[model samples]
Target: MTVFILVAGAFTGPHVWRDTAARLAEEGAEVRFAALTGLGGRPGGPGETIDLETHVEDVVAVIDAVTADSGGEIVLVGHDYGIHPVLGAADRRARSIARIVHLDAGMPRDGVPALAAVPDPRLRVEVAERAAGELPPPARDAWPRWGSTAGLSEAALDGLTALAAPQPLGTLLQPLRLTGAVAAVPVTGVLCTGNGPGVEMLQMMVEVGDPALRALADARVAFFELPTGHWPMLSCPAALAETLIEAASGGGRRLTAADASRPPAHLRPFLLDVPERARERAGNTDLYLPDGPGPHPAVVFVHGGPVPAGARPTPRDWPTLTGYARHVAGQGAVGVTLDHRLHALTDYEFAAGDVADAVERVRADPRVDADRVALWFFSGGGPIAADWLTGPPAWLRCLAANYPVLAPLPAWGLADTRFHPVRAVSRAGRLPIVLVRAERESAEIAATVEEFLTEAARHRADVEVIDVPDGRHGFETLDPTDGAREAVHRAVGAVLARLKG
Candidate 1:
């Protein structure tokens, strides 16, 4: 038996799920509805901070309340921002959940913040404006073109709206930590498409030009495309419910690569159910040991943004960090790729705790040749790598970074970050460094690394910069694209040669 738990998102309540939940119940499937803390009728007292932890607890409490049988694992269905709290709850209730279904939701992991993950300027500005607004009571009808019933009579819309309460500011304010949970449970996305205005709105907001979507398509997860707008539960209830049941019962068939190459379905992330074997967390970090007999040098590639490992369906054909690691492995070094906690688009650090953890974990790898292990970070991962290179685990031998945000710019990190590579190379100890900058990348990163190297020469640090043409910040792993795969392959070969010689 499988249990279903539907978690609501911002400006929504359990009522939004009333129709879908009722249908699932009719199928004799056990279902529960939960309102996020400070939203959907459960309001904190005046002056309550309503932080991220509080929202997580609200979901956890409901999970614990409903799972009285312990006979089955709960399948969590999250919509929109609800994905954050559900993910946090999943970590705490990893043992209790069978799988997670992200219905047009934000699926960032590793304490990454959602606001940071949104790349569209218009969307970013829109969310910021909404976030900054004072509390407005969220009503169902107020959702505006969210579901099929959006055009329903005024009375019905008002009824639905009345059921919703003001969303807590904390849900957006707090960062989520989900390294353990995502590793334990599988995640699936039920992508809504352009069937109507409601679905179109969601497509415009979340799916259109989303980096997450591209990342998802790159990962071969189980994805079912609903050509409706954001509220398929209301617009396409039968199809929505059918898909949910199919997912819960493991009845959905995998799409052929040919089928996936088509339009809407082709671009969608593969929706995969978590395998039963992955239900346990042997180690939060995944260290891929070489098949060779002797101790091998290992390099750890830290991911950027805030999505979790299982959230996106990474395709084997895709050019990605993992693809590069595979390249590294072919070169004879054990490639260790870790899914960092802060990369989950929901995590933010008041201190450098997350960065410190990544360094410690990589250095601890026995096969890594702690004395020789180097870091290759991308974008957000660069600053964290710098902290490690300059701060702790001072035994790092060399560094190879790509399209890295190395400048100690405040939005990304501290100001001194521009000088971190220099400091790591010049002051604490001299280390060999290979900096990969995209031709189209910001001149700031190139200028910063160059300035540091010149200054570091006084301390005699070795630094070399390679600018690859036609490359973008995330172009490396988007294999089958253009020059990214070839560039990455060449880069990996160079790293291997450097290590071997």
Candidate 2:
């Protein structure tokens, strides 16, 4: 017999898991819903103050009672914010656990709070500004900030809003600590496709050879997909129940781990073989000046990443950035590369500031023409380009995007429109936009690129698209064909033509 303990996510309580719990129980499994403190009509404790540890204790109490009363193997299922407490409890009860399930939740690290998992940059900022002890759940209409409620009906949506609780700021602000023992437990991931990445998308992410994501490729991790929204219990309880049962039985898809011996596509040699130009290191930026430079037109190449803060050979040092910078310098223009604090999605504000400061620094340099300049963005860093598009500066000549994601991916569930370049492009009267599109781009990025062009068309924005039919996301280093090189040249030439006064 399998004993299952289900922990509900934030703004919800065990009541939210009623239908799913019943299904699991009917399937001959003993189900217990962990009532998170201060949620679902539960009495808010002394002073109404609760935290991650408080919830951790709540789940732990259930685990202890269930373990003490029954001898069956324990399977813990945590959804959304519930995963933190699940992890917290799992860390303590690793020896007693059988399988752990992460149901549309983040893989949190030790000392990282739940707030780190919040997708929107603006929400994170707003929470900080509030400085309140507890954070109230978003109102009914603002539910998308939590996750996509694509499949929820009107009644379910109403129930969600009505039963939502005030989340203690400490629950999000406080960090989760763990022991290494939890690594031994087998894990299953129940992916709600509507709210986040499906199994295929997750496999694609793991294939990128991101060390952080390599854990997903581990044999211990298995994945199950449900074609529903964040509220799986409320959307498709039967399918979710079936998936949970299969997950408990260890029947699911697995991701193939990337080869440890091989370097990731990005680390491979750059496609371009241009001569390395003399580099001038300034504040958070590197400048490559053209030969006989006298206030030469400057192109600031912005490298994108929600790159790890500790990621070595930073974005500015990457071959793609350096290659583009060198190529621009060889074309009798100054190429500038800058390091920004876009280590996470929430860091976009700081990254934009860094880009702004770098641009000012570049314009102030004697080698760069202050009046004639262009800004180019790459990959995930594309959204940061929204700053210049909404209001084109007098000196701004053009903007270029190379396989950039102009809008947020569906999985991010961000409500903030501040970083969305697709919406901002309409504000640019006739600012030249040279977009280098990769036909073989990732679906998430490609989808947004298509949306951006559609929006750009509606507003009659000045846009020129350069297509690379056989290119990939990071085609500069990933796809080393003549087409990739030509596309790069065309994009740069277009910017140069615009910069020519």
TM-score of each: 0.45, 0.79
The TM-score of candidate 1 is: 0.45
* Model 1, span 100-208: residue lDDT tens: 8878654576767555433233344555676442346545533432233322455645765665565555566567887674655765678653312122222322222
* Top lDDT model: 2
Q: Model 1 segments beyond 4 Å from truth?
A: 116-134, 137-162, 195-220, 253-501
Top-TM-score structure, candidate number: 2
Candidate 2, residues 310-409, lDDT tens digits: the string is: 6666778888899989998988889999899987666888999999999998898887889999999998889898888998998999999999979876
Error of 1 at 151 (Å): 7.8
The candidate 1 region of ten consecutive residues with least summed lDDT is 272-281
